[model samples]
Target chain A: MTGPGQMLRRPLNPYLAALVSAVVLIGTLALAIEQRAAILRDGREILLKTEPVDPRDLMRGDYVRLGYTDLSSIDETLVTGPWPDRDTTIPVWLTLAPGEDGAFVARSASFSRPETVAAEEVVLKSLPVRVTVAQPSGGLNAIGRLEFGIERYYVPEGEGLEIEKAQNQGRTTVAVRISPDGAPQIARLMIDGETLYEEPLY
Target chain B: MLRRYLSRELDQWTRSGLLAPGQAQVLLADHDRRYTGFSLSAVLAVLAAVLFGAAVIALIAANWEVIPRATRVIALLILLMAGLAAAAVAVRRGAPWVAEAALVFTLLCYGAGIALVAQMYHLSGDETGFMLTWAVGALVVSFAFASAMAAAGAGLLGFGYLLAVQDLFSGSGTNPQDLSSYATVLALAFAVGVAAWRSRSAIAGHLSALLLISWVMWVIFETTELEPGYVLAALGAVAFGAGSFTPSPLTGTISRHGAVSAYGAVMLLSGLGLIQVSLVDPGLGVEMALAAFILVVSVAVLAVAGGENRLVRRFAYFAFACETLYVVGETLGSLLGSFGFLFLGGVALAVMAFAVTKIEKRFKKGEARP
Candidate 1:
């Protein structure tokens, strides 16, 4: 008995097969490069103070795990949107403003992107956080933990320890580029307010 | 291996007057001529491709700073194009095995390209996203070449995505309401199945089925209202019925190269075992009733498909023996001392073994009649 796949089988030209596969392969890589470059090209810059935890990834090699001080824990009173009933990850938009130490801190957060923003303040989108508990009045009892896409800074092999040491000394900061849509790209790494590694726009 | 075994057996049969003298040589030659597609060179080519791809991935993971990032990217692109060109040449020359190896190599290079791009930019995307992207690329390659190897790769990557997103290994419960996440996985699994069908690759088909089963297990892990044991048992019964009792043509198609009945029997027995585990300490009447039901199911499975399937027969014997010991231990262990329980358990297993041997003899006789 012939199956459906057997019925549909027809010989394709080898050159055409190769061409189609190559297009998919190259197109995926090109799209990834262009997306990252666009964010770095026309995005607002913000300096964030972070603490680093070291972990090794098999695919991306050794890296410094960055935890933002101001954005990691936001007060429940600052949240201005309805919270989900169940524990599930949802995207959050945070408005950042300069604090006393000249580093950006989250001033207000919302489930949806805010339309209006002050000139001095920048809105950055968090990846998602599992909201554990919610209040009856459309607020969260606990916002759980939040992360931006700029959480991990990949370093060369055996060089993560140097950044980890600097972070331990409270001297490490990250420069992030925020696109108009609240997406952020890591632009540079700094120690003691001095630029350590600047990202290329490739 | 089959050819050599046939040769030895034919020579003995000829000597014993079971066959004519020249028949062995003719049969051996025919077998050799009919099965010439598999070649050692093709296997070696695929192995070499895999080794080369792994080396490229390791180079990317090393974050090698000696060469500039853009230069490395360009080199990878060149290698990918070269692989595709090789595949085209092989296909044009009608060397299908070489074409398949080349396609596999190109897919691996594409995955390495994703990892390299992510590392170059320090993109903090989760592993699930990375695996999904790689899997999508593999699916495209599979469709383009109708390559079984690429389809199998996609199946594996889809399984990896499920593991990354769900707490399968960690045992941490995921939210049951996250059906949308599982929907994406189901779609990937379906694509893999279609790819396997297009390639007519039995290995890919098995992998696709296993992926779907893993997805079902993930769902079972998340939801608590339905008991997993019962669900597995019910599904297994349906699968077994479809494989063993379906009218011809469909039954022949499903069981042609794989034993669906064996897998079904396994799931059924596992479910029964879980039900036993959940018993904890039930009333004597309930315990006896559950034990009787398990024994009956084992015997029924043996009676249904045990003659034709060796795996099912073995599972039946195993379940029967285990249940005998459990009943003996539960009923007689307390009344008798530890030594007495061990003696009785040994005796019970010995009796079950004897019965199984008799059953095997009957099955052999039944087969011999045909």
Candidate 2:
């Protein structure tokens, strides 16, 4: 399309390129903020019992790792479907209802989504995880453990160890906000029924 | 870069009488008019932008409790917007180097914002997820700006993501998201590769290649169920085969200058060497076979693309030297001891020197004829 005297190729319009760059970056920030805000505003609140653990993140600061008691293991008795023989990671649908102690616990776990959600029940989607079910006599009933992504509670610097100590004493609880899509985010950390830290959605 | 190439060619043309001296100066002037030569100040401006970006990330990590979270988030967004707006102005003013640097700064701000926001909100996802998000954002900026620097940024981000994934998987329990993480890393690599090709950035392309190779190595290292050496050797073979035989689509639209094939050959040879080292009770025959394979591939690479591809030539030379020494040690060491091995190595080097001289002559003759 060009003679030897002309340029080899047409250059992209710099103005348009710059404009698109700005818009893309702005859109990314907006999307992140919007998602967090929506979860903070409209998600349902649920309290989870936590055990003791601690870790540090360079960028996210210090944190106490939260492992829920009931959610830790969906025992072979809790699994509602046929367990596969080979080791595998699969998505689990957990049906949650208030337990005798007033803390939400897994009522039924299934490979497929439950067909119904009762008015008082909440079904949360768990991240795909390796099901450590022992294939004993029959495959009809198998119990295993599953961990959702809501595990860590990031606290301010030098505060993680105290929370971990409280958690070890069975005095720590996590307040989570479950979005409509079954995604749960840690909303607050409570020890001995006193609110120690409340996460702000920025 | 274009100016350097044109000036060299112009000198030859003027000396050969293909261009009058007056005409040569006119052509040189015209080229100079169209292209901006390298400027130290412009480089400093970009360097400053990078430093600024790093400072912003460091500031976020510092966790300034004095500033409210809402204010920090708003400030980050505003900084990103301001950087982009300045870039747009630079573009309109016909300063592309400045614009690219500004875009890089903006992408950095966006990444810092993501990390800080995640920290503020107590998001519990792994570092892999954070890096993937950052890489994707950098890739978006790269594509939108058509900036090779931004493309290089994307490539670097993808590499960081792979390293994070390796860290995430190196711990005790099996990673349930292993497959997904690998897929995401590969996809990120491909995206950066695309950006590199689009921008004709060789450095970015090479970085993408490094990411792919590292991902394969990490996967092989994580699961010992599969032999790392054989898997890497097979992967290298496939990559080299695709790069050498399948021309158009396999090579994509990039002018790689046989770089992919060169990288594949390095992987192949390195894997074979690893196998030889890991062989516990191998007979002399197996060791001899590995030595032969390494020698043949290195020689073939040197012969085929040695003149055109500098990377291939250098790696080939190094591999050939190492394989020769290894073979010598295995065979002659037991008989003649270490001194004899050194003597044989010296002789082998002489032979290599002779062969290199002959090849150089042939290449020069071929160039002269053409």
In candidate 1, stretches whose alpha carbon ends up further than 4 angstroms from where it belongs are A1-4, A54-61, A100-102, A135-140, B9-45, B91-100, B168-177, B220-224, B247-258, B283-285, B325-350
Instruction: Fill in the DockQ of model 1.
Output: 0.52
- The TM-score obtained by model 1 is 0.87
lDDT tens digits by residue: candidate 1, A1-202: 4675565555567788788988988999989988888888889999899865433422234777787877877787898867655556667799999998888999999878988899999999887566656545575467767777677788877887778778877789988999989988889999999999899998
lDDT of 1 by residue, B1-370 (tens): 7777888999999999999889988988898776645688989988888988888898988888888889989999998999889988998887878988888888889989999888888877567778989999898888878887888999999988888777422332354436667888888888899888887777778788888877887778675667788878887887777767866768646872137888788778878878887876798888889889999999999998899889899998899888888888888879998999999888888888899899999999989999
Tens digit of lDDT per residue, candidate 2, span A1-202? 3373133223456667656766776777778777877887789988888864433322224666777877867655666766555455566888888877667888888876788889878878876655544455544443344567777666666777777777778888888888877878778889998999887765
TM-score per prediction, in order, is: 0.87, 0.82
DockQ of structure 2: 0.32
Please give the DockQ score of every candidate, comma-separated: 0.52, 0.32
Q: List the residue pairs that clash in candidate 2.
A: A75-A143, A76-A142, A76-A143
Alpha-carbon runs more than 4 Å astray in model 2: A1-12, A54-61, A73-76, A116-120, A132-147, A200-202, B1-19, B23-43, B160-187, B209-257, B260-264, B278-280, B334-343
Worst 10 residues of 2 chain A by lDDT: A52-61
Error (Å) of candidate 2 at residue A194 is: 1.3
